[model samples]
Target chain A: MNGGTNRSRFSDLVDDRVDEGVFRVDRAIYTDKAVFEAEIERIFEGGWVFLCHESQVAKPGDYWATEIGRQPVFVMRQTDGSLGCFINACSHRGAVVTPLKQGNANVITCRFHGWVYDRGGRCVSIKNEEAGYAATERSGGRFDLRRIGALDSYKGFVFGSLSSDVPALRDHLAAAARWIDLLADQAQNGLEVVPGCSTYVVHGNWKLQAENSVDGYHVTTLHSVFAATTAQREARDATAGMGRTESGRIKGKVPSGTYDLGNGHMGLWAQHITPHVRPIYEARAWLEEKLKPAEVEWILNRGRNLYLFPNAMLMDNPSTQIRLVKPVSAALTEVTVYCIAPKGESKTARAARLRKFEDFYLTAGMATSDDAAALEAVQDGSLGPPSQWNDMTRGLSDLVAGPDRDARDLGFEPASSCPDWDHEGMFHGFYRAWLERLEKGSGVA
Target chain B: MSTNGIDPALEREVTALINREAMLLDRRRWEEWLDLYAEDAVYWVPAWATEEETTTDPETQLNLIYLKNRGRLEDRVFRIESRQSWASLPLDRTVHVIGNVLVESAEGDAVEATANCIVHVYGKKGAATRGSRYDFAFRRIDGALRIARKKVIFIDDRLEGPVDIYHL
Candidate 1:
């Protein structure tokens, strides 16, 4: 929480334009309180924060506890078939209303004070109806649960904003909507969360983790442990002579690029996970034989995700990609990872898919190791005597325009290219939106 | 899955053994902790369910971690000592309360036992929280029960976070 002259240093560190394709970021963005404050005010508050996907709350009364900015909120499906986001705290004494990870309930009753609220945020009953504030209006002013300023959904993905001035959810999503639609539309049988949450807390600035998810550059070296492992090395070696086809897992090209999608929306397209790396193809083959041909294709090629600014990110790998970056401080962040599956899939298929994701990408996977190294390493650099600056200018001066200016082409390389410079645009777009919100003010959402 | 005939003297000895093991882990008695396991003991915390099949390779089961013998586990210990294991910087202090001990079967030297345990794990800065629930089995070696197979299924295993490098 270091403030004062350090604030300006942080502002300077984060506030810079991309001129020749290089990105210059100041060191204080990670350490200074002022910059973090402004970021919470502007970026985290001013943009659409991904709450959870429709799959999570498909059934009435289903709820998921998530955070938007610094606020701990839970989104629930009302009995009337609508979605709402409200602070998780009880109105009486501010204790967490429903402490469980998730479950189905028509109402949330505070265990501390016995105050009860229905899914619609109406104060249904007080512990002692007669003794506590005689004849008090339960559904009025200070009694009813406070909901987020704006609650909306794009396709089945739910998002909330605390800021009054933020644009409509779709407008805020902008070009990123296309990707969301592509991912959401994959499940013709309809998607549902796979009964678990991948919650992990890291010891680093939240932004560092967000950038790492889409950066694609750190994959090679940071994940050298995996690359060196016998199993992973064999996976890579197995695909050595596969004709270098881009259409399968790596996508159309190696130099698949990234771009600014306006309103803090950005995409790092084509940086796909290798199917061969995990037994995804083998599992899909097993599933295809047992499932309809169309169902098999949809399950296999669920495109990757970029994020809709602030704290949410779309992973685009079969399940939901909503990532909420809750900053614990200048030094710590907890990321709640959620995955979704087609609601109508057989029990066998669901089990197989969940197993695949859990094995390779959950808390204990090679992916978590990459994240652990990147975040901890960044924490080391930021906490130590501040360096002049860190360079994010990997793929500068090579911005070749594709069908869309934001969608440029990366050159020939492994689909899992470490630090794909072209993907830096997504990282840049996020920071730009973040800078705008910080210059503004903060409010509770 | 059944607790048939329970032995009083044997139960007292087994409870003592479990308590002693818990103390060793909490006290970071690495060598004594290693000695508690049989030579061919297995320590497995599967990433997910083992596929239902008669023949499936344990090597390719996609386990969170599956240590075959004491040597491999010692290698993990060796890495912790030699390398910078950040998660263990302050070293997590643990309290494993093992209770509900039941002997399922007795076959020669091996005795199958099932127990309900609650392990509270405390990080360096805070009070402990529930760690996991274990379903353990023991085998007799030299007239004393040693850990034959340990399966610790964490309630929060599916969640992402630092894993326990040391045994729980």
Candidate 2:
């Protein structure tokens, strides 16, 4: 690891020495309260963060409550068929407008004082407006609730930004948009988020999950138990001549790699399991009928773990899931995981998808619990003085150059070249983008 | 007609079975706990959702766990016992208290029972109290009451936090 050099205010927090392909981030970034607060302001508040799936608010009156950094926000479907993202706080006294996790409501009245707001976020009624002596105040829209600067959807995935100056959602998405297209293209009609998310909090920094989502390096080691169990099941199934597509078949060797999608986005791609065991495999004929043969092959053969910067991740193949990470504190993070499936899937395909989801990502499942434990242990270890810098140079030497290698590569476009599956280039790219956003001191528009 | 009220004799037998299952979990006797289930048993721990939400349909709704048969349950136990389950590496000390056992109905060979359970977990991180409602369907297999189906609804479902289901 290279020694750090002071560059910006948070330079002490991240050591980005790209010349030597060495990136070491200070552990304090995970445990320091001040650093956490600064991240909320400079990173999350400034960048485009995923809010919820469009299907969650498919109906005009539907709304799903979520947060960007510490700001509570809700995404509601307006009568005009457009989605409106608003701050959950009421303009009156700053109380939360909608307390429910999710529901349908034509008009949301603040629970505190019954200040009614329409789906468009215009304050239509203030409890006893006439008694408040606010004839001019009411007409001028003084009490209209504040709205998020940008709200956009790409392939049914919704994202909101707190800063208006941030780039458009399409520009923010960049290369990551291609992976999202792959995910949405699985279904002919579209994909829908399964109802009821598996929510849990981890005693670790939010970045741990961000890194873990694309960190293929830890799968073989941290989740060895899962691998072992799968191996045993496969042995037994083979002995019994059971040819059913089991969920826990261990893949011995397959081509895999990592891509550094631009705008802090990264993806881990690998070979998919047998078609019989995976829904994407079962939907091959259907997808092929609608899509080109190469497109169908890409959907079936490639398994993707796409990270949309700061928070959300879409895990495609093996099973489809959306992981949303929210930082509660420097050491406490909340995650809500949703299982998503392509619309109009056969009953057998949906069942297989659900089973595969349970085998991996569920709270009690083999993989997620293991990852959670490892992340918590990392957080605990970082609290001590033993280690200061967390190294992310595993596959840095093998990073494939982007399209604009001569200039500053924003990683906006995909390259035919790929890195080793277990490489740490994704982490390097992620932290680089994170440091840039922090240094810019505003949204990376 | 059979009485709708709890059957005293059946309640004692069912309560003992429930307590025995808890003891096996606390002691980490995974194989023995596995023996408490019949060959074709279904174990479900539904995700925490609103009161109106129906999690019975696992395909449509989310569940923390939904094991179809005894084989899958055995697989879960094997993972924990193999010392490969990272979450169960430093096994947390747990004490399960099973009470309020009510035998809701007793058919010819199957019995339906509800019990309130409180699991106190003590680990290196800290201690936590998890409450749940356990609905069980017990079948008399070879004159021994074995769990055919177990549906666990965690009372603290809304609280999104680390959940170690190894001992649940």
Instruction: Give Cα distance to truth, residue A90, candidate 1, Å.
Output: 3.9
Model 2 off-target regions past 4 Å?
A1-8, A234-251, A403-412, A415-417, A442-445, B1-4, B51-54, B158-166
Which ranges in model 1 have alpha carbons more than 4 Å from their true place? A1-11, A15-17, A20-22, A127-142, A230-256, A269-305, A317-322, A344-352, A401-423, A443-445, B1-104, B107-110, B114-132, B138-149, B155-161, B164-168
Per-residue lDDT of A1-445 in model 1, one digit per residue for the tens?
2335446433466645566445777666777676776677666665678877787677899987876676678898988899988888888888878757567898999899889998987888898878757676674657778787889998888888766667788777876776665555555556555543445677678878777766656544444333333233334335342111113222223434455556666665443345442223435555666654544443353345576676777765433445667877777777766555555655544544544454335445434544665576677676644464677656655443323422322111111222243345455566766766665556444
Q: What is the per-residue lDDT of model 2 for residues B1-168, given as tens digits with 9 covering 90 to 100?
A: 236666678888999999999998888787888899998898988875554563668766678788777877777767878887777778778999999988888889999999999998887568888888899999999999999999998766534334555447
The deviation in Å at residue A267 for candidate 1 is 3.2
Checking candidate 1 for backbone clashes, the offending pairs are A13-A26, A38-A438, A42-A437, A216-A419, A217-A418, A217-A419, A255-A410, A255-A411, A315-A321
Once all C-alphas are superposed, what RMSD does model 2 give against the true structure?
3.7
| Interface RMSD over true interface Cα atoms for each candidate | 7.8, 2.4
Taken over the whole model, the C-alpha lDDT of each candidate is: 0.60, 0.78
Ten residues in a row with the worst lDDT in model 1 chain B?
B48-57
Candidate that would win on DockQ: 2
TM-score: model 1 vs. ground truth: 0.73
